[model samples]
Target: MALKPSQPLRLFAEHLREQRINLTERWMKAVFNDADLTESDRLTYEQLADHVPAILEELCSALEDQDLDQVEPSIERNAKLHGRLRWKQGYRIDELVRELDLLRQVLLGAIFGYAEQYPAFTRRHEERARYFIDEAISFVTLTSIREVMTERDRKIDEYTGRLERANHELLLKQKLVGELYESRMQLTRSVVHDLRNFLNVFSMALQMIARAPARTDTALALANRQVGDMKTLVDELVEYSIVLGDTNAFATEAIDLRALFDELVAACVPTVEAKGLRLVQRFDRELGTVVSNRLKLKQIALNLLSNAAKYTKVGEVEFDMHVCGESQWCLRVSDTGVGIGAADQERVFKEFERANHEDVPGVGLGLAIVRELCRTLHGDLRFASHEGEGTTFEIIFPLRLDTDG
Candidate 1:
């Protein structure tokens, strides 16, 4: 059975059909002028008006028949297509709903204008027209929001998967590099250990030859000194290898600052005096106990003091210990020695790097080890120097070591 058209609805439908083009134009103008609908600015006139004309045709048919079900398929198809296009054009869900609402307002105004022209158009016809427009706009808004959210979720998942794969590949490469480095360090330690053993045997032989009743004392003394220098180099290499391999090698304990300084100065006295240089020591009266890695602290102090004694000729090597702040302390080793030049100072903390003085008895691992150990103990090493004016190396350490490091 065919449903008969209602006279008022048929008249309203006819009016909407005649004003369709003008209504669409008005809707476009409203969208462009709306601050919230800025996404439409990049779209062309046809692109922005896509499927709207079809929607208006279906709306007119549904109004005239007074049966929305007959025109539902066409209406739904056009509305969904418009939604997807808006999503691709970067329209937010709110903007999409707002534009549709604006269209509804424009059509309602046309409806009122038609009602005023025909005396038979009553409140019942206006209400029916409003209900159909509201239902259509509601369906379009929900459909568009669903499509936009679906696309958004899919893109998020894709980007997250890519990031995970990249991080996994990075971890694998890092593990491989670490394994190679460890293998090289192990081989170096083995070779250096063997060389130290040979040097020790050679030193023993030179000592025995010197004791012989031969006039080779000067030559034997020089040979022994050369062996000693080689032994020192090997020892530094071993120390550097150990520090590199095990970051947590040192344990913290309460150490007496005055006692530690006294021990270090006593050890360096003979070397400084041999060069006709004085060893000066000064301790602040408030020197107290500190909780730190004792062995590492001793190592840093000894390296600085030894470097000072090795380079100075006649001036004093001063070892000063003072309270830097309430929670920290400072050790300053200043020397009147052949100081490092500006060019060499930058590489002073780099492995196997030496200063301009090639005659110095070192393989240049001293300062590098000192710096690594300083950082491991939550401390810092800094220096100031000028060529021929000598250098001052200062290290500041926290009173208490942080175990987390």
Candidate 2:
């Protein structure tokens, strides 16, 4: 069997030592001295270096073992230990230990092979034997270096991939944090405002009763109106909290764009007549359908229409509906009202963000709810306005295909 070819044994042992030295140098001189190293990273590297001596002893013992069968088993056991040190007992230590392990295996294998082959020569030929061992060790060392470098590069690439994924997860977490904070702030404002309104109504009623022990019908009726305002304020606060709370609870369904505007106009007709304002619904019936939460969609439309009525003294609020493309439908509500300033247009969609309007009565949660509702439905809400001219708000949704439920 040609003595089972001693080349593999020599090659494995040479790489084992080269890898060990290279790793120890990187850790002791490079990684340990770097100021940027985290405390945790430094400690892991320290632990790895402390455990390397025992592993090197095993490599040396396997070289002298006379039984070739036992040599293979010893190499296998040590190789596994080396892999764990390089990859598992933590990253900082594993990095160096892995290299060391590779060098040990390479050098030990070369040493054992030369010993086995030279025992047959009777004459003293130390120089010739040294030359053979040196050539074999050099070739094996170069090959081991190339293999270690390839593995090192792979580890670096893996580290980079993990970093990018962690960064992306952090960004998502930040966005969720902002949403949760906003919800908490809204809850606080709701409680405070409701308490103030309740106190004001109770005080007014008590004063009216005190002045007239046997209350006149007209005085009682006037007190009752103040009580009604308190109720309306309470209802608005509750509704705002409910809509903003989970934003994702609404059930989605297919809706017709033109028909949705028509229903919205009908519901607001009574409010429009009382305010002496005209609402015109101009839409293309062919605009067709979209998939969304119907009740939530209606709420968004009613909020916009009510806002328009609140701001307009006598001008008209028109709904212009059309299909912009094959996969989208555009629904715009344009009003010739007090209008909005350029800066205020963006702020209007933020919670508690009210514009400067002395005539309009609001705590400023309507449009904020509208924007939130739009996002939940996978649509977009945007506005363009010129102060004192008019404001136009556009909403777009994905078209309902024939395959939609």
Best by TM-score: 2
Q: Which residue ranges in model 1 land beyond 4 Å of their true spot?
A: 1-219
Candidate 2 versus the native: TM-score?
A: 0.63
lDDT of 2 by residue, 230-261 (tens): 66666666777788687345566778766777
Q: Write the per-residue lDDT of candidate 1 for residues 157-228, one digit (tens) a residue.
A: 988999899999999989988976875675467557646765776666677676864736765776677677
Cα distance off (Å), candidate 1, residue 53: 31
Q: Which stretches of candidate 2 lie over 4 Å from their true place?
A: 1-139, 142-179, 212-222, 247-250, 401-405
TM-score of each: 0.57, 0.63
Query: What clash pairs does model 1 have?
Result: none
Worst 10 residues of 2 by lDDT: 120-129
* lDDT at position 206, candidate 2: 73
- Model 1 has an lDDT value of 0.83
Return the top candidate by lDDT: 1
Model 2, position 38, has a per-residue lDDT of: 37
